[model samples]
Target: MSIMTQLEFELEFSQSEKQIAKYILNHGEEVLSMSVKELAKETYTSPATIVRLCKKIGLEGYNDFKIKYSAELQYDLHHTDRIDVNFPFSKDDSYPMICHKLSSLYQEVIADTIKLIDFTELNKIVDLLYPHQHIDIYGSGNSLLAAMSFQHKMMRISRDVNLRILHGEQVFMSYNSNSSRIAMIISYSGETNENIQIAQTLKENNTPIIVLTSVGDNRLSHYADYILNIGSREKIFTKIAPFASQISIEYLFNVIFSCIFQKDYEQNIQNKISYDKKNDFRHPLSSPVSDEIK
Candidate 1:
């Protein structure tokens, strides 16, 4: 997990630990150069307390924590061009600057997502997405939009997929879906009650479920047959758009779709070819004489 992820998962942290976390989150790059004693002094806590905080978050010690933070910080500094998710662009920014920031934001979101992906689990989900299996995807709002995108991709390759954007539709789909069917839920918060209800219904029906959510366990993760996490560092104020989380989810979904696409690449190509030929009549071509008259 990234240091930022650890900080976000601090629901059980002590007051001193939270204080240290807040400082480190604000000045992660600066933390890289500070010693344990320095951090303890700055956070107004003991050195032992700092080390304990590091261990609580899965780091070995303060030094180990610093190393991880420094490495991630360096990667972000070098690769992302410093696009702040909280303040991606300003009104006064020029077109070129906006372009640069947006581009960098996309790259950073995808990069962070890639770091969190578990290839083994991803392959398992891909295997389940074979042409024979029916996939029912459920989500709300923007997550539903992402599900529609995946549904479109699956359609192009002739895979069976149902996208349920409404709560009633999702429940109905889950109720009718058989054990052979698979369910994929896309929710960054993973706390959507309706989505969770759909997942539960599917589970009761013996349907396998794969969840794409932000890092850290949540109520939804408990029932998933397979869980996939995405990078999310956007703040509450930045809720103007769930940009980072949505991009992360879409990026991971693309990876899974590509894996499934490759599994039947030759067959899929042939199917496309046949489909195009069969649909050719639907797109009528005008004759040269008709064009000349026009």
Candidate 2:
């Protein structure tokens, strides 16, 4: 977890510690240059209390905390582009301004998603998915749409992916799936009741489960053999829409599809081209003159 996320989500700190955390969050760049005593004075606490807060968050001491926190702050400043994930635009904005804000939001979400990826875990997920002829995906709403998009991409490459939109069918699919099939569960909150039940059911069948979720601890992550974190800056119920979560989920799915394609690059490329040519039915005005694979 990033230091900023830990500070925002962790609730074990005392009042003073939370105050210090708030100060750091509000003035992250400023905090990067502050000494332990200076930070303590600014937060109206003692240096020892500051050190205790650092320890509580799993750092060795004030110095260690500063080192890690500074790196995270620097990365955010450079890559986040300072765009708000939850409410990227306001009512008074012009069309161009709205376009710019939405574009920046997409870029920021992708950057954040990239930072959260664990390459080792990603490799493991791709390895597990590559050998499976059929995969099962479980999600709801926007997440389900992202899964369907992924399913479409994999299908072009001669891989089968199943998704059940109805709750009863989802439950039945979970029960029927066994260890031979791999299941991917996508839940932004990572605490969705139905997703948890599916994860539990899949676990009982000894199936390997890959979970795509937001950062922080949640019930769904406990049952995952591997977890991929999406951009997590938006509120569960307060957003205009799930702009960040939806884009992040789609980007992650694209990454997974790309990685899987890379596993057998030549064959997958040929497979897609072959499928496209065989299914082509466009008129001359809309389609390429020659349907040759280049």
Candidate 3:
């Protein structure tokens, strides 16, 4: 988790710790230049209290906390253009203005999402998934749609990815899952009851879980062996649409698919090409104007 997110969402801090966290969050860039004692004095706390706050959030000390927090602050300053994820445009906006605003929203959300990605964790997920012939996915609503898209892409590469639409069927699948199978659960809020139930079932069976969720501490994250975060700028109930979450989820799935494909690049390419030739039924007019691959 990013330091900014951890500071914002972590619930175990005491009153003095919360005060220190609030001070750092409000004056992020300025804190980079100050010593631990200086920060403690400013927050009206002792240096030991500040260090304890840093360690509580998983940092080694104040300096380590500052380094990570400073990077996040800089990234936010550069990439976040104040695009409102909940309402990117107003009702009276022109079509052209709407187009531009939506486009900018997509760009900014993707940029913010990229900052949350940990390549080491992603590589571990790919390694765990690559050796499995079958995988199960669980989600609801829009998140389900994203999972279905990933299922389709993996199927094209000869992987059996299962998705059950019905709640009972999903529960049944989860109960039957074993350590041999890997399951991925997608929940934006990470608090969906059905998703939590499925995650629990999988956990009892010793199945490794991969979670795709928004950045913050949540229920679903507890069961996950690996987590991939989506852009988390949107409000759950107030958004006009799930524009940011949808795009971020799709982008993460695409990156996963592409990375897995690259693991056996030549063989996968040949397999796709061979499948295309065998399945081709298009007329000459329907073919590409310049067919270089053929």
Candidate 4:
């Protein structure tokens, strides 16, 4: 996890830690320039407390933590210059410029998401999913759209994926789920109340729940059997759209689909051929209208 993400996760555990984390996050640049004593004085804590917090987060001391944190902050600043979510496109940007910025943003977010993924945990999720009798996917709005895409791809491979878009239906389906069922709950913030409620329902029913959420601490992670993080660096002022999160979700889903398909490659191909032959239709010829412009 990134420093920001780690801080967010730590916030849910302790108040003193939260105070330190909040101060560092809000004044990262200042923290980089300050000494351990200065930071302690700034956050109204002692130097020993700062060292303990640093060690808790895996650093040897405040100096080591500050160095690592500065490196990450510098990297973020360098990479996020042009494709910032808050200032995605300037008014002076031409169409081509806008397209380039958008493409670059997608590439960056996808690469960042890849770095955050744990292959071992991902493969475990796939292992858990492969043997399940039913797959229940829960989401709302744009997330539901991603869920439907997963549903379609899974169905093409002859897997039964149930998508519940409505809040009540999600609860109902989760309530009916069993041990043989797997629930995938997707939310950009991972704090959606309805999704959290559905996750609770799935847990109560003894169904394993997997969560795909933005990279940070959130309420939904508490209920998850497996947590997959999606990298999205959108700021509060950049709530104009969920572009980064959506792309990350879709990219992750595509990866999962590819893994599942590779496991049953030949069978999946045959299934595709069979389904296409049954559903595909050709438009009848229109008397060679290409040559005559009547």
Candidate 5:
């Protein structure tokens, strides 16, 4: 997986780390020269985190990365990218910056996520999953979290949703799957060795395979009966987190479920109402429904 993909996997990183990342993206050359101690003082993060950040930026260590970056700045100098003035350099101290950063990311994801949102492909995936007795989800490396999250949602509606997060055991368990089941593999790169292998294994066994990946044209998709492509993200050099990417995928699942649920909306509502009546799951609102016409 790419370094950016790994960035996406760090779903639980602190706001401070995000702030550090934002600062670095805005000023990479300056920070690249700074020692871990100095960078921590500037970013208000610990030296330990600075080392982690170095790794996050696809570097071996601070010294090695700084040397290369310093050389590049001196050697193959390129034209500067126009910094978006809207992102005011001094507007945020810390927490507000996180919100602004997230807001910007959300907007970008919405824009790129729409460019190739093929309803046809999405509907095809829905079809593949709709009537299946069991649905198996597979994702390795960074995307394993996404795979597990999807399985959680689907399992609410599906009694048999197989989520294979453990790579070795997943491969072992996949072969034992009944012929009636459908498998969906999640990979942002669409090139994860484990994901590709799982897709291949499923394809060879005649199990229907659905692939959810960023790039539509990949080896895994070649074997899939359905391809639901998410956001088309350009590579970011600083570090890329899949916050927006995962959001898009989760949105896709929600849309799919909404469509499926709409098929029998009336009955579904009735069932809910009946269940609430029996279980007292319904909450009484401050403004209650009236029996008589207003």
Candidate 6:
């Protein structure tokens, strides 16, 4: 089922069934090949309950339901490992199948990116970040690691202005707004309601908002004055968007950084020198530097 269709039906599942539904929805990678008993244990429901839930969701049996849902989620994750490595009985024709589909996916990514990007809107966004005293990035889960990687890159090239806010206090620290100027919220789905609220609150407080999100039509995207789109199909996960979107977001961020550096050729060199010097903290490892200096 498509993500929207699954969400629609899942919303109707009874309280007990909802747990099973939510587990499969959120943990698609783990659930894709799980046995009925395994799924039941993971969902904290009995095998009988898993069967009942599958029937209610309009599947013939547990295997039938699992197969359909598994295929959909696997397609969303861009994982063809199992299919490519089929059993001895299976034919080798799948090599061509895999090649054709993955190549198509790549072209789709390029086309979708081009269609979604608005140059005028993007230029407006650059203007906002261009003048910021500092740029604070907010993300959690798998995204937090990506945010930190981006922060490391910017800090290395642009000195102290980039922050990767992982813990509690540092995230809310921007509210003071005494030094830092802008905030970028990185979430594959704009539906990360907490991240959305952060952007909303920042807007309320007069801090500009820049969003990196996969869903172009989401509620949070509507509020965002500047958006960098990550065009991954959000089918494998429910509590958040798909992980494949990371490729797109990282690609966009690198572009933004390159643009900034390109525009300020001389300052890019100066900033690099300053940031390098700032990061080079010295301590005596083998000798007393004070005595040597004297």
**How many angstroms is residue 196 displaced in model 4 relative to the true structure, after the best TM-score fit?**
2.3
Sliding window of 10 residues with minimal summed lDDT for model 1: 285-294
Task: Encode model 4's per-residue lDDT on 1-294: one tens digit a residue.
Answer: 456655655634366777888899888788898998898888888888888888776578988988888987887788756477546678899999989988988887888889989999999998988766588888888877777888888888878998765548877887788888888888766667788888888888898989998764567888999988987575422355777777888888988888988898998898887766567454333555322222
Candidate 1, residues 1-82, lDDT tens digits: the string is: 4567667556468998999988888886888888889988999999998999888766799888878778777777775656
Off by over 4 Å in 1: 1-81, 277-294
What are the per-residue Cα lDDT tens digits for candidate 2 across 1-294? 346655765447889988998898788788878889899899999999999988876689999988987777676577564877778889899999999999988988898899999999999999999989989999899999899999999987778999998768988999999999999999887767888999999999999999999876677999999999988877665568999999999999999999999989998888777776777666453466756545
Error at 122, model 3, angstroms: 0.5
- Against the true structure, candidate 4 reaches a TM-score of 0.74
- Of the pair 3 and 6, which is ahead by TM-score? 3
Model 1: how far is 243 from its true place, Å? Answer: 1.8
Clashes of each: 0, 0, 0, 0, 1, 0
- Give the winner by TM-score: 3 or 5: 3
lDDT of each: 0.78, 0.86, 0.85, 0.78, 0.63, 0.63
Better of 2 and 5 by TM-score: 2
* Cα deviation of 294, candidate 2, in Å: 9.5
Q: Is candidate 4 or candidate 6 better by lDDT?
A: 4
TM-score of each: 0.69, 0.73, 0.72, 0.74, 0.60, 0.56
TM-score (C-alpha, index-matched) for candidate 6: 0.56
lDDT of 3 by residue, 1-294 (tens): 456655665447889888888898788799999999999899999999999988877679988888878777777687566788879999999999999999998888889788999999999999998989899989888877888888888988888999999758999999999999999998887777888999999999999999999876678899999999998866566569989889899889988888988999999998987887677556364567624444
Positional deviation of 19 in candidate 4, in angstroms?
13
Error of 3 at 273 (Å): 1.3
